[model samples]
Target: MTIRDVATRAGVSPATVSRVFSQPETVAPGTRQRVLTAAEELRYAPNPVARSLARRRTGNLGIVVPDIANSFSAMIIKAAQQEARHAEYALFVTASEELVDDEERQARALAPQVDGLLLTSPQASDACLRELADIVPVVVTNRLLDSVPAVLTESAQATGHAVEHLHALGHREVAYLAGPDGYSNQSRTSGLQAACARLGLEPVVLGPFPARFSSGVRAADLVLAAGVTAVVAFNDDIAAGLLTRFADRGVRVPEQISVVGHDDTALAEMVTPRLTTVHIPAAAAGATATQLLIRYVRGDDSGVRRYELPSELIVRGSTGPVTARST
Candidate 1:
């Protein structure tokens, strides 16, 4: 029931029991094992609040995402939670509703209660993030800010490959359905532009649309108006919505308009024709970010600031050779 009880059963002093629980590596392995065994038998568990107050650590990590409902964010959160648990840390997660102000507010609020923070695709400005980092150890995913540790996926490379694929299939012009304004969206746009120039293809830049299914539905008209043979969407949710609109309008995919999407989310496969998309390692990014945060929180200063994950293009049923249109 208490450290004293555990120590009595393990035939050790109370200080030894405390050392075994607080810094097990400092205690002898045999002694540590005996203390643990006795503690288990006696049903003795350290009080987290008392330990936190004594050590000045909450034993909790904070995570903030733009949208908890998004599949991409969900994957990241789940993996991060698993990694935190493995490191014996609890996670406090918050959603920012895709707003920069909300993200900053959440970070400020969580900074006092958690040992560190993990921010996934944060929309907050660099100044805001830098200030937040000053208040607490922060690890970022999907955004690159100076002096902040980050885990970034290769968005530009994936977009370039998608463009190459479309070009090979004789798509002379492609319309890009843009996502919300952020570092990730900026990277995707840059990739699309670079690829278009490299491939000698015309690029039709569309809306700074919300990364939602409804936006995709609305984008269908703009896409058709652009007269591009192929369309590259910001993410799978938008791509799925476009597919629905195309189907309703009797426009055959691949035959009339080939489509490509990013983030290879579950919606990519759930659509009638599986989407050709760029696969971003959401889970890996999350796990890696958690590890980096844990390391930083523990005062491991190896000057490791960034971890870049690769993204790949996946060909599926949604895209094919461009067809000739009747004038």
Candidate 2:
């Protein structure tokens, strides 16, 4: 049914229902509750386009991610939604599936309807990102660009922590499952290498995986061949994949080859042997990016700012002291 139908039943005007959805505090709490109950009973809903036109805003924020299926991105979306709700805004999340073209198209589709955009692991080039920012307020998370604002980037720091954790476990040799060669992943690789040198450990760089589970399978062979005692995966999916592949190959985790993943995704804990990983705050990143974008939208002359949230090394069953036999 329509909003007007529910309005008639609730004895309130259509505007009251609209305000109840968009700006609830403006309506009396009792009246608001009555309208909501009436609308639910009648299954009434308002037209988004009409509401958007009237408000001069879609009352929404756009979020573009390389892949929504990826736990990191999924967590960020959850956080962005919560943050948006706290800010009295709605969120429209989109997945680009790790394609530059798809990301650009999604951004275009979302720009007209939303007040601003929050991008995670953005695939677009700096020039393209600059252009996109001109169209709307854009706050990027995970990836860094010279001209754009970024939040929750922990490539160097987190990678270093992972290496140090493995080192503490008596792993003098570790393999890093690299992601596709991009600014973000490259930074991570570089950081891990630096940490390796500092810890006096040998670092082996493996496949620049497509940041997917299948890539983890491919990486397992490389790890087996290199004879590294531990593997630091670029993300939780790759780490989980490596763990699964290792199991399929009859290689035991922490018994033979220890594994560590980044992102501390839900899958990390759900696995049989809970993954040892770096806990990156993807949700916090989403929330902070929303705050920053809103600040920029409100003309906060905040200088181009960068925030690097803290990441922790989670000691779990997947990682243990290097087997003396491997050494």
Model 1 C-alpha lDDT per residue in residues 146-180, reported as the tens digit of each score: 78999998799889999999999888879999998
The lDDT of each candidate is: 0.90, 0.84
Compared with the true structure, what per-residue lDDT tens digits does model 2 show for residues 163-220?
Answer: 8878887888799888866666876788898998888877888777888888898789
Instruction: Count the clashes in each prediction.
Output: 0, 0
Compute each candidate's TM-score over C-alphas: 0.88, 0.81
- Give per-residue lDDT, candidate 2, residue 261: 87
Candidate 2 lDDT score relative to the true structure: 0.84
Model 2 TM-score relative to the real fold: 0.81
Which portions of model 2 miss their true places by more than 4 Å?
1-51, 301-304
